[model samples]
Target: MNKPNKAPNNKEFPLTRETWRYIKRRQKELDDAFLSKAKWLPNDNARLSALLIERGELINEFPETFKWWKHKADDRARIIDEYIDLLHFLAGMDGMPAALFTMDGGYSRIMFEAETDKWRRLSNDYVLEQLLDYSPNREYPVQSACKVVALATHIMGRLGFTDGDILVAYDAKNAENFKRIAEGY
Candidate 1:
């Protein structure tokens, strides 16, 4: 008997509901594995706090979701708070998964903001000892606040803007355009 080798038609080989369910389960497993292995969080709070404070506000300030908190009250605030709690715990070396999981949007933002400020306040020398913070010079680190501010200014320089350039935009799109240009570099 000669067996014909042919591609299975979609209609002839319909995926069973259970097959979809199994596929979903495998997908979830893979996602979980990737997330678990991700280096999204620094090994310790001090470093984590520095990264968060330096970049946390930018996360919410993205054009797609910028100022979303101004409209949504309860849900956003709660999430931001939760994120704050996580940052606090993490910064203090007391982080737990449950605390992070319980955070709502608002709390998440709050935490992100707090971590940013905390890192902003620490001294350059303290960072070397307390947070193991690094500097290109190794022997001397510039003020963390100054470094962050300069980064913001340089980013603006990329889009034909300068440290003193003033932009006035009336609409979200315009504002976003300016922000994009400023941030593009």
Candidate 2:
């Protein structure tokens, strides 16, 4: 698989080609191990549903993002962890192309200039729209997958997360997932 090109124009979103490669390799390892134990692969519809569910879980970490009246401190660490959890499934989905990790110039810009809550809501809605477009019957599932990845990366960037943060969190979560599989989880 071709590695992603240079990092995007935004320095804060420093997902270098090496980082992308590591993520792909690690996720593949996790998927292979999981499949070996489970002995059953999910269909495209099932994968899509899992992605949607994970997205919901990630959103749930930031209640203040949607709840206008609920003012609470943002649990930044939990939010990032949830986002990485979503990535675990997204990266492992069947036929997730290497190009999904490639970030274009357009994605480097924030989708919304509004305040945190408004921008987060808008970005989440946009990502949901892309996720809803994915279907097993689609002529080009890769295209839909690409849209989701780009939107997902954009969300991370908007949240002010660095590529380093993703790598660290992914490693932690990945290790935990492996531990779970070993324990027959």
The C-alpha TM-scores of every prediction are 0.20, 0.68
Clashing pairs in 2: none
- Each model's lDDT comes to 0.31, 0.59
| Model 1 ranges off by over 4 Å | 1-54, 62-142, 166-185
- Looking at candidate 2, the ten consecutive residues that score lowest on lDDT are 105-114
Best by TM-score: 2
lDDT of candidate model 1 versus the reference: 0.31
- Candidate 2 clash figure, as a count: 0
Q: Candidate 2: misplaced stretches above 4 Å? A: 1-14, 94-142
| lDDT string, candidate 2, 32-121, tens digits | 899887767765455656766766666666656555577796688987787787666656653544233332221222222212223344
lDDT (Cα, 0-100) at 12 in candidate 2: 26
